[model samples]
Target: MNRPSIARPRRPRNHPDRFLECQRAVEDTVVSAIGEASAAGWQKDEIIAAMIAVADDMQLALNAKVLLSVETELGKLMKKYR
Candidate 1:
C-alpha cells in the first residue's frame, strides 16, 4: 500500500530546533491523549486501538482525501469504537 504524502511547507533540512519542536509537539499530543483516555476509563487495548485508528485516519486527512481502502477502514474502525 502506498502512503499518501501531505503538501506541507518546506522546512530547513538541517534545523535541529525545528525538528525538536515538531517532535515535542507530537509527544505532547500523545501524552495528552493517553491521560485523557485513562481518565475516561479506557483499557490498554482500547487506547492502543484508538491510537492506531487515529494514526491511520490522520494519514488520510494529510493526503487531503481518502482512498477507498482508507474509507472502508475508517468506517470499520468507527463502528468498532462506537
Candidate 2:
C-alpha cells in the first residue's frame, strides 16, 4: 500500500509587498498619465487630485488585518523559493 504524499500547502496568493509593488507601478503610470493629461489640457484639476489621493491611500493606508494575511502568505512563498 502506498502512503499518501503530504505536500506542504501553498500560501495564499495575496502578498502585501506585492500589493505595494503594484501600488508603485500604478503610481508611476498615474504620474505619466497626469503629466500627459496636463500638457494636453484634457484632465480636470479636481479629478487628478482625487485619483492621486486614492493611490496614495492604497500604498500607505493598508489595513493591519489584511496586511498580516498578505505578509504571512508572502513569507511562505519566499520560503518555497529558497
How do the residues 1-82 of candidate 2 rate in per-residue lDDT, one tens digit apiece? Answer: 2223333324444855665555554665566766766667766786588777996888766776688899999999999999
| Best-fitting candidate, scored by lDDT | 1
**Candidate 1 global lDDT:** 0.72
Badly placed stretches (over 4 Å) of model 2 are 1-12, 42-44, 49-82
lDDT of each: 0.72, 0.67
**What TM-score does structure 1 among the candidates reach?**
0.46
lDDT, residue 73, model 2: 100
Please report, as a residue range, the 10-residue window in candidate 1 with the lowest summed lDDT.
Answer: 1-10
Q: List the residue pairs that clash in candidate 1.
A: none
> Residue 30, candidate 1: how far off, in angstroms?
1.5
Q: What's the C-alpha lDDT at position 66 in model 2?
A: 85
Q: Score candidate 2 by TM-score against the native.
A: 0.37
> What alpha-carbon RMSD in Å does predicted model 1 have with respect to the real structure?
14.6
